[model samples]
Target: MDISIREGILTPDTFAGLRAACGMPELETALVGRAIESSLFTLSAVNGSRTVGMVRVVGDGAFVFLIYDLLVVPLWRRRGIGSRLVEEAVSRAKLFVPPGRAVVVSLFSAEGREGFYSRLGFTELPAAGLGAGMQCFYL
Candidate 1:
């Protein structure tokens, strides 16, 4: 199968289609639209004219990079499309990450999702039970 991964400009139509591919019951199209328009990097995996998968990268574009919204349609799962998408994104980041600078690439994986990320070369940062603490503000 010929798969093309490209940096796609996010629009209302593209965003809606990508959101649908996510297969998440609770995802909001409005928020996704807002994010796609505002995020730093958005990627689309195209098999012919169909967008099979999508992922969003949000970060300072310097030191801290966060991977978000890595979604692959059910039909495309286990087909290596998602892995290629992640690989392409990581490759792009490597180009910009300064040598020896304090660069951090982070992602949050839900329970049972760790294995997926692990297969992609991600591992949990050790929990030393010491630090400023992991903090998140959600409404």
Candidate 2:
């Protein structure tokens, strides 16, 4: 219930733990470390010493910012922790742009989670005259 949002302090283990807790596939710790460190910005939700959720921002600071790897442990879902992580991540992304300029903050929402993000001000792709976003994965 007492959650604090912190910046860039996630260990690979903590990240992988949250992923597993949320039923996402695990990644190699080395790769997870690289991803965490290379993130343009990251916010983690900590309740006491445990990491309950996280969101990472990736992409060039000028043109695009992708809200990647947003995960909240099942125990903490629907308690506003995810929303706070996203709101904080987007707030940080806005800081990267200059006055009178704009930048995009994008994310690939999990299936059935679109409504959660839409309520937080994200429009689905292919709306607003933009083509639908696409992705491919390599194992």
lDDT of each: 0.75, 0.91
Q: List the residue pairs that clash in candidate 1.
A: none
Worst 10 residues of 2 by lDDT: 98-107
TM-score of each prediction: 0.80, 0.94
Model 1 stretches with alpha carbons more than 4 Å out: 26-30, 99-103, 127-137
Q: Which ten residues in a row have the lowest lDDT in candidate 1?
A: 125-134
- 1-139 in candidate 1: lDDT tens per residue? 7778988655556667666656555457687678777776888888898787887888888877788878788888888988998888777776667776655667777668878888888766554653332668999
Residue ranges of candidate 2 with Cα displaced over 4 Å: none
Q: What C-alpha lDDT, on a 0 to 100 scale, does residue 73 get in candidate 1?
A: 81
**Top lDDT hit:** 2
* Tens-digit lDDT string for candidate 2 (64-112): 8999999999989989999999999988888999976776889998899
